[model samples]
Target: YGDLSKPYGTGNPVKARCPPNNVVWYTLESYLPTLVYGCIVDAWVTNGKCPYACKFRYESNPEPGPFISAVNEVITRGRKIEKDRVVMYRNLLVERALERLKEIYWQWLKLSNEDGPSLASLWSTGTVSEIPTLKPFCSLVAEKKQLDKASRTLVLGNGMVRREWHNKAKLAKNFALLPNLESGDLNPHFAKTALMDLVEDAINYLEWVIVWPTVVQAVRSTPDGQSHLDPVIVLDRS
Candidate 1:
């Protein structure tokens, strides 16, 4: 079904209808890593941009370097405070847990419509009118005591737990620094503004790690961004 006038199938209608190979194929070996690094760098740079109006006091000439340093310091301090805040939040969680446990214990002791203590009351008060020893409930009490001990240990630990608690305390202290901001106060606007800055700085620091010079060097050393290919053509005469 081919045309006889064609040589090497070049003039054949089928050959003329063949798809073109104009599209180039590139497979950069390090493209993915480079792209990821670039993304991290961009993200960090974006994070470094301040969200709120920051006040600065100039000692001499106001340069971007000094301004940046001041801003970075603020971000660092804020992060430290945020870490501390997490500890406070954990403490509050423990307190709430203890309160819930107390509520359950009280409910279990309350009798019916009559103004009398239920049998469970003897377990808590150790009454001779009932079982000599409510040792069965000792397990529950022991569990609660263990939880309390753990909480106390976490509070007093000299490790990360302690640091976390200290940081949370520092965060609380910082909030009190603003005379306008009072204890047990909720200010969405202020919190949102402060958190935004703090988050941005943290993200920026992460980026700095991902796009570090050493990482870039390692990426470059490998074929992470390189590619290779070859093209060949054949001809025949009859």
Candidate 2:
């Protein structure tokens, strides 16, 4: 609000913002179908980079291709998620839908788009990889909701139910956000926190679901002290 002299340097803040890269390196318009465009858009938006670490290049027109209007719509929705902080469930649903769509995209590309006598394969190659699934993380939300409802209605419980619900929700939220998390090529710290939270959740959940049950079972069966089952062996069998 103070200075307007140096427009390019500071005044024109809108134009000073960084724009996303364009899809110029790959012939997406020529090869990929229009329906799969949204998947590419989601991958780009969530990761802040093009799918498969595509080659960077300059383009006169920075707009998305005409065939990729669907992708633009999805990007618009992600913006709302960033603002309101709600609709996480909807975002997860969108990720799953795009994951399914990309399967068809990859199959079609493999059959139709083939490089002819190109030495590019010797050096490197571009590929549309499978987007990870969000099912396990989504399940956490549902389970948390159940715990929350039980906590409210339980007539005899103390604080155990509510505490468990909060713990599970935190874990699930960490995992769900992993799909949208991006690791910067220049700065490694961008994705470290989210990745660590996810790994911690997995380890804790595994111990609760698999390890604890086996240990209890082994302890109960060996009350006579004649024989004992090793916890490691039980978990390994599991």
Candidate 3:
């Protein structure tokens, strides 16, 4: 993600690369999702069976807390230096893997709701060993948004609000579940929406989450505005 934080220096001045990924972007982003999610889509349409593990583990028998914390802090510091591009380049593959994992998670959520599972459990954080039997799935609650048919527009925060946006907000009502089986192959649309969500998450993390807080600290540390910290500029999301 940080690799994408800057305008690529070598590209033809118009567009930036798709945030360099170590695991070939074509295979990681385009191919794997199509293959894995394609199978899930096929199963949902036919046999009504989806396979997924409950809660995933980041590491098995993890390191001591103090050592882990120290290393993470050091990694964050390393990212501040110009020479840290190599580290960012390597972790880019990890970032892509994580995103694909999240897609699998959402697919599991879609399967979990086959025959009226508890609504509260939809967003609940716990995981169990028992997997549910999948059925021809359909989300009665999910709906389509047509930009042309929008009856009202509202603005919130720094962004405009519309039906599609509204649908996204209300999406939690169904725990971000996909549309019904009748809708047919909503995986493509779901993948696109997931990518947009990931982009927004990245923007918020860098700008509001990290940059603004650091700026506040810099201003406080130097009353006369003579701090040596570099100015951080966040480019608009592509």
Q: Return the top candidate by TM-score.
A: 3
- Output the better candidate (1/2) by lDDT: 1
- Specify the highest-lDDT model's number: 3
TM-scores for candidates 1 onward, in order? 0.19, 0.18, 0.25
lDDT of 1 by residue, 120-227 (tens): 332212221222222211222235554443312111011111122222433433322322212112122222222333334543453364346567686667663352
Writing each residue's lDDT as its tens digit, candidate 2 over 6-107 gives: 111222213354521222111121112323334443442343223444545435234443222333443454422232322342344344334433332223
lDDT score for candidate 1 against the true structure: 0.29
For model 3, which pairs clash? 138-180, 139-180
Rank the candidate models, highest lDDT first: 3, 1, 2
Q: Write the per-residue lDDT of candidate 3 for residues 170-198, one digit (tens) a residue.
A: 35554245332211222334334333443
Q: How far off is residue 228 in model 3, in Å?
A: 25
Clashing pairs in 2: none
Poorly placed runs, candidate 3 (over 4 Å): 1-188, 196-214, 218-238
CA shift at 196, candidate 3, in angstroms? 4.7
| Residue 62 CA displacement from its true place in model 1, Å | 48
Give residue 18's error in model 2 in angstroms.
Answer: 29
For candidate 2, the clash count comes to: 0
